[model samples]
Target: MSIQKIALVGNPNSGKSSVFNQLTGLNQHVGNYPGVTVDKKTGSFPGKEGGKIKVIDLPGIYSIYPKSEDERVVFEILKDKGHKNYPDLCVVVVDVTNLERNLLLFTQLHDLKIPTILVVNMVDLLEGEGISVDLEKLSELLGGVPVIPMNARKGEGIEALKNAIYDFNQTTWTPFLKQYATHDHGLKHLPSPSEQIEDTDRRFKKITQILKFCVKRAEPSKSRKLISNRIDKVVTHPIWGYAIFLFILLLIFQAIYELASVPMDLIDNVFLLLSQGTRDALPPGVFTDLIAEGIVPGIGGIVIFVPQIVLLFAFIAILEETGYMSRVVFIMDRLMRPFGLNGKSVVPLISGVACAIPAIMATRTIDQWKDRLITIMVTPLTSCSARLPVYTLLIALVVPDKSVWGFMNLQGLVLLGMYLLGFAAAFLAAIIFKLIIRSRQKSFLIMEMPTYKIPRWSNVGITLWEKTKVFVWEAGRVIMAISIILWVLASYGPPNRIEKAVSAIPIPENVADDAKMSYEEQVSSVKLENSWIGLLGKQLEPAIAPLGYDWQVGIALITSFAAREVFVSSMATIYSVGEDFEDEATMLQRMRQEVNPRTGQSVYNLASGLSLMVFYAFAMQCMSTLAIVKRETKSWKWPLLQLVYMTTLAYIGAFITYNLLQ
Candidate 1:
């Protein structure tokens, strides 16, 4: 059966993505358009009478005339009829509260004449302010195009939308192409007086006329505006805004620590049992050992952190949905300008806390090259989700879980401080880059503040699911592959080194053959320390010893450079390769017990944990991030400089932290 193609387009924050998620459910996945960095999301669902409809969620843009790379993608895909993914029908989502501004794009799409449906989103928001749009009249004004009032976040109007889709007649409007005419046939044709007015003025005039025809609103009372302004006065005040932003961050981390502990402990135990069960049921062999020791532990290290990941992203989504994040952006922009960044840089900088990869891609929307490049260069300094596993593990080892000052969790406070340290480092680095780099272009932050409302839980849930799933799969693949490789390298050594090491251990007097478990553990540990991977770690021991890391940590450092989250997996394999699996202790417990050979002290002390945290906070480790930086900058000079500068900062920071904390 053939599937009909439909495209969804809208200005930013028009609920376009919410609508897409509502229609497609779990069927959609995001990919990039061919030869572009902008996201191209497509999905399909069953339609009326055994038919299927495919939907494309295009990048949000304000107009067909592009101002940024992402906007250019929208123009190319919509205007180029021969483009592979061009839509047969277009659904233009319009934010009804901002009707006049949104209609400008809808009007442009109408001129292009691609069988359009106007999705008047956020209708639920209008009634409270005594504003309304006559849907039938709006449709008539658009040449009888279908108009659907929707609250996509609540699943309202979905059935009507589906019915409209089933009843759609693509042939009703012939595809009009003359408005974008590029040819100059019979070119001498003269000046028509109508063409004298600027195109922008004409679009604005049409939008105002349409508003008179269909829209109705009550002007807000002076008192209401005054109250909002008063609230903004404090919320966006220079000192108060920064204080509120910091307080909110602290509150979020505190809640994550308090609420997520029970579930995280449950997940940790479940994985422990799964690993132990594999050892008990399966016949003892290399494959059994691999499954029980390496793969299970590697995956567990990441899986155990799911609760934290979910809570972190859920809070972020809530802030955005409520329109508070935009206020923070405005506040941050005021603080950022001195460092050569503006409020627009806050979006990517905040997103970097989730993951540096897509956060870097997000910089494409920043119109100024200099500001965009500065954001891209220093973004990795902001701790990401990949760092969460490592931070929580180490924090547990050193920082007590007890309450401090009668209300705060000590560990949570440390977590908040660590995140702030990353931000501080990013700003300082930006300032340094600002002093070094030269630019003559000026950019302004043009942002619209949406009306504040309670967060839609449905939208928050969808965002949490998408982000957590992406984190797991992206980290899982790299971890599993590296875990298997690490097991092989740790288990066997050159030319019977394993056999020679085993045979060389002297038998203890009065030791029964059946009671030789301790002896066997000793032999295994010795064999692993002499294995190929161990030797490599030892080679780097001299450089890292000053920073409180041993050979095993040295190995994890190298492996995790491929991806920061791989540090957990690498440690899982490194520690589990020659250890007992039925002990029921989580990886954190095992790490806490690890001893430093030279001093006979615990390896993960307050000093070493803090040192490691500082190292990751400032380091450039992820290869995928660097490759993306190269692609985005279109130059190796930037990424190479990034690698060098970040590594230097990491080493010095780690050195200072270890010495001071110790």
Candidate 2:
């Protein structure tokens, strides 16, 4: 067999991914099927014989008749004999507890004439649930297809599974095409999709016949079902479910604030020391400034937030691994329906709180184009981790670092409020987009609620690791480039003005005797004020000054288009290079004392801090998010709409906040 292919196909919650992981341990590659958001996972391992077995893990689906684009991928490859992905062997994973529903998809693959083996997964739950399946009889009913019962999670029967694959591959079973061609109806492939109904009905009748001959059942206890249902009583209840969900979100945000703060501070201090060391150790030049100010602080900006990203992804992973994310989807479905989104959309929306790129990718699970587009468009409204550093910096500057009512950290509460604000904005904007977009297709929420179990620690760690890599590399490149450009812009100026501006900062007699800012400080200020970025910041100042921001804040606004977190690094670089250093002060400290020339007051007072925070809270600043949106929508229109609506909201919200606070 030359590169024999095995495609893992099963219904949702059938433990197919676990089985794939077991079969191809530590040898997997994840990529997207060209031009689609659906993930394609392929891996290989040595077989019982001297050959290598290539495994393809396709997305979970209920049928080969393709309800979504994701499902269509399954049908396209399986139906085309010459397609590269047409599997030489199909491993159909079946959830032993929910074997009936899983068998439906398996039967579809059988009718489509694909060589297949049935892997009865999660059989460990069978003994506990008082159920048993006869593998021999099941194989006999399906024309003697190989059947292997295994608990994929514990690696039980993995050796048996490998042996079965080796045997099956050696003598691959020819599909039972007569089952479809000889049906009394004499049905063949129909050109229209609706024509599959009669064929599906025939398949169901055959499935019932197979179950009668090959399956045995005992009355199982209702305790497991009751446990889930009872929990749903509060969690899925219309009125209370919303309350519980809000409480859960609050807990997540509170943890982000309480847990991630220490690491963030430590990272900040380390970067400052490194910068100082570079300046002290090396000769002053363009290279030294680039290393000390540009690259170091740029990298520091992203790595500083890793702790928060990990915590966010960890919580989401555990929720998904425990099967609670499905309940979140079910409950939020009702809340989302009026906004013209499916309950399944809750996944993407919630994921957006971590990052919109993956969140938008998560929308692949949404079958309807209209609902998925709406979800993608509004997901960015949910403040992601990129905005966390910006939120933290601004909140610390404006909100006092004290507890409210001796219980809550006032800053943490404000942080939570900002997140909630982001979510609310997303919800409201989704409603507006819903009204504008037109689609004849219906929306649905057909999701499987996998049995709740203790989250597998290995799976959770893997999830955290993968997501962190994406965050670091994807966001890291943009930040590093933007930081370098920003430093150059802030460092140099037109020769005539660069020199004259330094001389024009008239050192008062009081400045030599009793001035608050030294002559050196004034010169540093004028130098920045005349630099390329400063010139641009001044040109844009009239527009942002309405929000009580000066030209310096305006510069941050421009550079942060690459990412929201770049605001932190931009400010760090700008202030570090713009101010004369006595003792190294943190970004917040320097921001606090920096005065406005016109008003002679602190540039970052409560009004401007809140204004800046609100601006970032609603802005569309991530280029990657826009690119993904363009890919998903297959057009620039929706992403453009998102950019316009979100940027408008940011401006309006910031304007109101500044004037109101002032």
What overall lDDT goes with each candidate model? 0.84, 0.82
The whole-model C-alpha lDDT of candidate 1 against the native structure comes to 0.84
lDDT of residue 396 for candidate 2? 73
TM, every model: 0.94, 0.91
Best by TM-score: 1
lDDT of 2 at 490: 86
Query: How many clashes in candidate 1?
Result: 0
lDDT of 2 at 448: 73
In model 2, the Cα lDDT at residue 73 comes to 82
Clashes by residue pair, model 2: none
